[model samples]
Target: MKGSSKTHLRIVFTLGIIVLSIYESSSQFLNDEFCGNKEVLTLDYRKKPWKGKNQFLLDYLKKIDYKDNIDSVRFRIPVKFWIYRNDDGSGGVTDERVKVFMDSLNHFHKLNNTGFRFYIREIESVNKTKRLNLGYFVEAPLQTIFNHTKACVNIYVCDFIKKKANGATYVVRGTYNIVTKSVMLQRNTSSTGLTHEIGHYFGLLHPHRNYKSGKNKQESVSRTRAYKGSLKKGLICERNGDGLADTPAEPRLNFLVDNNCNFSGQALTDNWGDHYQSETNNIMSYPTHYKCRNNFTLSQKSVMLYKASENKYAKYWNTKDSANKIYHFDIHEPDNTVKMASIIKSNEKQNHTFHKIFTTGKKGLATDKTDWLKFELNTENTSNILIKFTPDKIVNDEITITIYDEDNKLIKTINTSKQIASSQIQLKTLKSGWYFIEINKKQSVSKKLYNYSVELIIE
Candidate 1:
């Protein structure tokens, strides 16, 4: 009887263990079971592509209208990035430390306008299991964590380990699935890290590494070809592939490294380019220091857009405002009374007069007097005409209108001020001619007003 009782007790204990394991696995999969404290959101699809390829993925991106304009591309995908500082008191994340990190990310986003909605979440979990640690053991379980998430993409951040047993500082797993519409990022922290890993997440391969399937070791020929091709096309230098078409190629050996590890001073291609070595700066390349790591090349932007379009991750083209064609023009000097002008020629000529339309004003700071001005142009006929403006100086003010040509004049003057915020004047009566619109203000301010975009209807 005693032996039987002992056997029954062991059986009960084993059953309990099994139940716990099942619970843990289920918790990882279900969103509601996530420690009752994690934040998550299911982003909605904004626009649908006409011909379906990556329809499911493309539906989620915010549709940007660039059909009529080239300077600014519209994106529908609202990307929100949250940084969780899980450093514990034993050199783990602290509030102040996390703030610094958050600030850096914010600056980078602002500079690039990658168009991801960004936010920082500080997780203060007392449970050791929920806390994020920067070691091998902590990262080991992340693979399972990633497997559990339904996200199309999962990026894991951890500290770098240099042992042969440890993988590269960054590891990207899984291909972009057009069917499932998902991808994954497995990365380790290094001096020149996250950016590179993020690049991989977007389908960019390492400049020095061969990406053919089933290949384990990097070959010299693979590295050489990447360098030579990128250089010829001006994508990246031989030192680091910065993902630009204009910058010179950089060799992989020039990358920077921290001098404390066994791999230190081992001829790394990690350093971000300095002004002396390269003229243009890109975010994907190794940075000499933290400050230098910023910006995406135009080619990279196109590639990202293409991928998003191809994977059906999101729609980039805006088809709503079809009648009005938009165009971008940079105004060098703007002030209370300065002329912003552009020559608008039509493929087919239709007689039209000039009028006012919609304008978006500048935001932040009054240092540049020109930042306060806004203007728009319209015509009654499809004939080409030079449209010009001398805006009223009011910081961050917008003007929109539809006006008729009151008088037949080659040049017309529209007055704007604090009292009269906006006005529309028609130019249909006037014949096609070179018109001058001038705004005169104090010449002390020397900043270029960018994203000064306009849309016009020929008829």
Candidate 2:
């Protein structure tokens, strides 16, 4: 009897391991923000803050705008909101709450008169369970982030970032992972906190970056140049003081504010015993109350712009595709059927593939989903037409490209591959009106985001 019991237990253990392996393959992990239930990030000291911001932008822009004297382009950034659903699987915050969040973030504008802005376009719901729970110390680092982090900044909102044995809740007010280019905020976080966290995302460090030692009521503080919090004064400027000269070096800001919202300085000193200046109007400065935080010093704004221009995931800002991505929800969806395609000119290439299409169709395999694109060439001169179709990402060599005429008739069909995805396919147009193009999977088995670029060349 004892031997039989042991055998049964071993079999059960093996089965459990197999089940866990299967579970791990499907679920992904994102990093943590707070302790137990505190509503704030633990805080990262800003090193070399705004180190190369101003000069890099000036040099890079000059090459295109004036130095090279070439074409100029506007810069923009995209932020993806990942909302954590309730543990029981109910959706997270209401649409109104999401709107308020966006409005709070949009308060900051692009500097340098550039048409740069942060587009809060895509919102995804992450299921809450032990496998992907928010309260646990899950460490989903950069490689995992890059694999799933599309070409946009990702901000996740959740509950109970950290937990306590007691009934207390450590709400993560807000956090940003510089390496991963991701941000996190508690569901109830204020707009002011949201703005500050994103400023960190844009490389704007706190005026008192990394100065955690000493008590607030000290009435005065000092550190040597060798100290981690030391700022050196020089004939040129104080570079170590938060990486910008406009904001004065402070041992730290006095969070206390009177009714008039003024900086009640404590007259702190640096390592060299120089009396530190007080800063109150800067968003990068720490504020005990969110209302006390209002503006970024001019230098801070310039650095944010530079970071926005150079973020790896932020390509949508400076491109024409941004037009379709303006609203939180867009009406200009990709039409899947042959007849309902949007009309475009020969020179106008339609590149709509980032967001999901509400509508889809089945053309080749019953399971295959289809995307439709249409264009018109109304010239009497039937110039040699070339259609170039590029898929958003690679599929299992199972895509079928179909062309249809103005009267909604199928003209030609071809299978696509990596090398030949952009073949010189001709469209048989009897009249100078609209022609439809359909791209889909051979079988109902393609996960490539229904994002593709189709262009017509009138040679």
Count clashing residue pairs per candidate.
55, 18
Cα lDDT tens digits, model 2, 275-383, are 6556565666654455666776656655666666566534445544554343222112324345435555666676754343221134311211555677765654455
Which regions of candidate 1 fall more than 4 Å away from where they truly are? 1-103, 113-148, 151-196, 207-244, 253-280, 311-459
Q: Write the per-residue lDDT of candidate 1 for residues 1-459, one digit (tens) a residue.
A: 999998887667445433433343332222111011101111111222211123222333334422212334333221212222334433333434333333444445445655331222112222233333322222323333323222223333222211112233322221121111222222223322444434444544333222121212222222223322532321123222322323333332233423321112233222331222232245554333434456655445544555545544332222123422221212222111212222334322222111111212453212212222222344334444333332322233332322222232325454443323223444454443333333222223322221232223334
lDDT scores in order: 0.31, 0.51
Number of clashes found in candidate 1? 55
Q: Could you give me the TM-score of model 1 versus the true structure?
A: 0.34
| Candidate closest to the true structure, highest TM-score | 2
- RMSD, each candidate, Å? 19.7, 13.6
| Error of model 1, residue 143, in angstroms | 3.2
Instruction: Score every model by TM-score.
Output: 0.34, 0.50
